[model samples]
Target chain A: MSRGTLALCAAGLLAAILYPLVVRGLAGAGVGVSANYLINVGMLVFFVAFIGQSWNIAGGFAGQTSFGHVVFFGTGAYCSTILHVTHGWNPWLAWPVATAAGALVGWAIGALAFRAGLKGSYFALITLAFAEVFRILANSVEFTRGGLGMLIKADQRPENFQFRDPMWIYYLALALCVVSLAIAWQLTRGRFGARLVAIRENEDAARALGIDVYTEKVKVLALSGAMCAAGGTFYAQKYLYIDPSIAFGVDKSVEMLLVSMVGGAGTVFGPLVGSLVLTAINEGTRSLASVVPALKNVQPLSLIVYGAMLILIVARLPDGLMGLFGRRKSGKRHDA
Target chain B: MLEVRGLSKAFGGLKAVDDATLDVRQGEIVALIGPNGAGKTTLFAAIAGFHTPDAGRVTLEGHDITGLAPHRICAAGMVRTFQITQPFAKIDVRENVMVGAWLRTGERAEAMRRAEAVARQVGMGDQLDQLGADLTVAGRKRLELARALATGPKLLLLDEVMAGLNPTEIAEIVDVIRAIRDSGVTILLIEHVMQAVTSLAEQVYVLNQGRMISHGTPAEIAADPAVVEAYLGHGAAARLARGAAHA
Candidate 1:
C-alpha cells in the first residue's frame, strides 16, 4: 500500500477506537447527548461502509454494476433471523449460515447471468429484477411472517449477539467495518485483484491475455455477496427486526451504490469516506427541519437534499472524494 | 505450430470468414494480408477462440482446440493481440503486463519480474509506471505486444500491430517481432503494411472477401496475378511488375 493509503487506514482505525469513548465522555458531562443516538449514527456509518465495501469487490474492482445487492443482504438477514428465531440457534452460530446462503445465491446469479452473456445495463436490470422477486417472495412466505416483519426479543446476552448497551453493537459494527476494509485492501494488492481490474478495463483483451473472465467475476461476486450478507446479519442483530421492505428494498441497493460511488468506488477507503459524508448529510438535513419551521411538515426533505447532493457529486466529482485528493490518477473509466 | 482448417464464420447472411485455411510452422514468421473487411481479424478471432467458427477446426501443436474459450486457447499456448489496441486504461503499464504474466505464475513477485522483462523486451521499460490511457499510439501497440509476450505463448497472433505506427515505429516493432521469432515463438500476423510483410514474413497469405486468394514467398505473392487483380488492383500490379523488372 502507498503511504497515503496506509495513513488513511491508520487514521480510520484511530477514529474507530476513540469514537465510543468520546461519546461516553460527552454523555458523562452535562451535554444532553443520548448514547442511543451516537450508537445509531455509528452503526449506520459502519454498516453502510461495510455493505458499500462489499459491493466494491465486484462493482468497483471487477467493473460489474449490480443493482440487486440487496438480494444477498436480504438472504443473510432472513437466513440468520429464521435460524435463530425458529430453530433456537445462536445468532453467532447462524452467522456463517447467512454468509453461506448469500454466497450460494451470488454464485447462482453469476452462473446464470454470465452464461446468458448479460452485461452492462442488462446485468444491472436482471439483478434488480431478482431482488424484486425475492422481496415479494419474502413478503408472501409463511416462514418470514409475511409483511408484518420478524422481531427478536430484547435479550441482552453476549451469546445471542445482543447487548444491553447500544455501545456494544457500535463496537461490533466498527470491528466488522475494519475487517471489510482490510479485505478490500488485500484484494486490490494481489494477482486476483489485477485480473479483476483487467476484466473491468476490457474483457476481451483480458480473455486474450489468459484471464478466465467468468470465473474471476463469479469469485468476486461470491465474496462480495458473503461480505454483504455478513453486514446484513449485523443489521438484524442490531435492530432485532427483519422485514421484506427493510431487507430487500431497492433503496438499500441504491444506498450501497451511492456510498461506494460518492466515496470513490475502486479505492479501499472510498466507501468509508462516502458513508461518513452521507450520514453527516442525512443528519444535518434532519436537524434542519427543527431549525426551520417551514420545513417541519416536509418529512422527506432530507431525502430530497440527499438526492440533489448525489446528482451534484456524480456530475462534478465523478471519481468521488478520492478524486479530489488526486488518489485516482489512474483515471475514471472504471468509476462505473 | 498452428493449423486452421476450413474455418467458416457468418454474421446473419454475410460470411465474415469463409473456408479460410492457413498454417504457421514452429519457428517461422507468417503474414496474413488482406484489404479492408477481408476477414483477417475475424479469422484471427476464430483461431484465438473469440468467435466460434461455423465450420472448421483449429489446432495448436497438433492438439484440437476448436470452439474453446479465448482464455483456454491462450492456456494452450496461443495468444493474440487486437487490431485496435485494448489496453487496461485504468491500470499502469506494469500492471497491465502483469495480468498476462500472471497467466504463467500465480506469484506476484514472479509475475512482476516477468512483466518487467517483457516490457523491456518490447522497449517499454522506461514507461512502466505510465497509465495505459496516457501512452502514445505506438506506445500502446508496444504495450499490447509486451502483454502478449508476457503470456509465454508458443504461437503469437499479432493483429495489425503496425497499423497506426510511422515508418520508424514500424521498423522498431518489426525488429521486436523478429527478435520474438528468433526466441522460438512462432508468429502469425495480419498486416496491411506491405513493407512489414515483405521484410518480416517468411511466407505470405493473401485474403480477399473472406477467402485465401494466394500463399507464397513475398516475391511470388507480389507477382501473383490473382493477388494483383483482387487486392492490389491492375494499376499497382503493373507498377509493381515494372519495379520488379528493373530490380
Candidate 2:
C-alpha cells in the first residue's frame, strides 16, 4: 500500500470510531432534533455518498454513465421490505439477496446493451428508460402497495432492525458508509481499475491491447449495482417507508450522478463531499423556507442551483471540487 | 511462438484480412509491411484477439485462442501496442507504466518498482513524473513501448511503433525492440518505414488490398517486381521498365 492508502484507511477508521460518540455528545448538549436532524441529514449524506461511490464503478470509472441505478435501489428496497414485512426474516439475510437482485439486474442490462454495442449517450438513454419503466411498474403493482407504497412498523424495536433512538440508525448508516468506501477504494486501486480506465479512454484500443471490455464493463456495473442496492436496503430500514416515487425516482438517479460528478466522480471521496455539501444546502433551504413564508413556493430553485453548479463544475473544473483542492490530480488519460 | 492460420476478417462485404497465415518463432523479430489499406492493423487486431476472425485460428504456444477476448489473450502472454500512441494522458509517465505493471503485481509498491525498471529499460526513466499529454510525440511513443513492455508479455505485437519518430528516436526504439527480443520475447512489428523493416526483420510479409502479396527475405522481396509495383504503383512499374530500357 502507498502512504496515501494507509492514511485514508486510518482516517476512515478514526471517523468510524468517533462519529457515534460525537452525535451522542451533540444530543447531550441540548441541541434537540436540530442536532438529531443534522445527524439525520448526515445519514442521508453518507448513504448517498456510498451509492454514488458504487455507481462510479460503471458511471465514472468505466464511462458507462448509467441513469438507471434506481433499478438496483428499488429492487433492494422492495426485497428487504418483503423479507421484513411478510416472511419475518432477518435483515442480514434479506440484505445479500437484495444485493444479488441488483447485481443480476445490472448484469442483464450490461449484457444486453454492451453486447449490442451500446455506449455513450445511447447507453445513458437506455438506462434512463429502464428506470422509468421500473418506476411505472412499481406504481401499478398492487403487492408493492401500488401507488400507495410500502409502510414499515412505526413502533421502534431493535429485534426488527428498528430503534427508538435515531442515533442508532445514524451509527448503522455510518458503519455502512465506511464499508462501502473501502470497497470502492480497493476496486479502483488494482489492475482491474487500470483496465476499466483503459476501456473508458478508448474502447477499440483497449480491445487491441487484449482487454475484455465487455466482461470488465459488466462486472463493474454489477458491482456498482450491488453496492447501491445495499444502500437502498439501509435507506428503507432507516425511513421505514418505501414508495415508487421515492425508491425508483429519476430525480434520485439524477441526484446520484450530480453528487458524484460535482464532488469528483472517479475519486474515492468525491461523492461523500458532494453529498455533505448538497444535503447541507438542502437542509438550509428548507429551514430558510420555514423562516420566510415568501420562499415556500420556490420549487424551481433547487434545479436552478444544481444546474448552475453542474455547468460551472464542468466548464471550470471538469474533474469536480476535489480538482479545485489540488490534493489530487485529474485521472489519467485512460481514466478520462 | 505465435501462429496465425488462415485468418480472415470481413467488415461488411470487404475482407480486410483474407486467408492470412504466418508464424513468428520465439525470440524472432518479424515485420508485417504494407501500404495504407493493406489490412496489416486489422490482422494485428485479429491475432491479438481484438477482432473476432470471420474464419481461422490463432495459436499461442499451441493453445487455440481464436476468438477469446483481448485481455484474456494478453493474460495468456501476448501484449500489443497501438498504431497511434495512446498514453494515459493526465497521469504521470510512471503511473501510465504502473497501469501496465499492475497487470502482474497486486501491490502498488511492487508495481511502481517494476514500472520504474521498465521505464528505465525503455529510456524513459527521467520522464517518469511527466504527464502523458505533456510529453512530446516521440516521448508518447516511448511511453507506449514502456507500458506494453511492463505487461510481461512473451510475444509483443507493435503496430507502427516507429511511425513518427525522428531518426535518433527511431534508432533508440530499435535498440529497445532489440533489447526486448534479447530478453526471450518474440516480436511481430507492423511498419510503413520500409528501411526499418528491411534492416530489423528477419522475415517480412507484404500485404496489398487485404491480401498477402508477397512474403520473403528483405533482399528477395526488394528485387521482386510485384513488391515494387504494390509500393510505387503501376507508374513505378513503367518507370522501372524505362530505366531498364535506357540501361
Question: For this target, which candidate reaches the highest DockQ against the unseen true structure?
Answer: 1
Would you estimate the TM-scores of all the predictions? Answer: 0.95, 0.91
Write one digit per residue (lDDT tens) for candidate 1, span B94-177: 889999998999887788889989999999988988989999999999999999999999999999999989999999999999
Tens-place lDDT per residue, model 2, B1-247, is: 8998889999999999999999899888999998898999999989887789999989999999998888888888898898888887766788778777877877877888888899999999899878888999889888888888888899999999998888888888898888889988899999988778887899988888888888888898888778899999877877998999999
Please write out the lDDT profile of model 2 over residues A1-336, one tens digit for every residue.
Answer: 456656877997687557667766887887665656766776787788888887777887788898878888988898888887777777768889999988888898899899999999999999889888888998997778789888887767877777888777877877777877777676566778777877877786566555678999899888888888888888888889999999999887898898899998777778888888778777777788778889879864567678888999999988888788674433331231
**Colliding residue pairs in candidate 2:** A210-B70, A210-B71, A211-B71, A333-B88, A333-B89
Question: Residue A89 error for model 2, in Å?
Answer: 1.9
Q: In candidate 1, list every pair of residues with a backbone clash.
A: none
Summing lDDT over every window of 10 consecutive residues in candidate 1 chain A, give the lowest-scoring window: A327-336
DockQ values of all predictions: 0.61, 0.41
Give the interface-residue alpha carbon RMSD of model 2.
4.4
Model 1, runs deviating above 4 Å = A328-336, B234-247
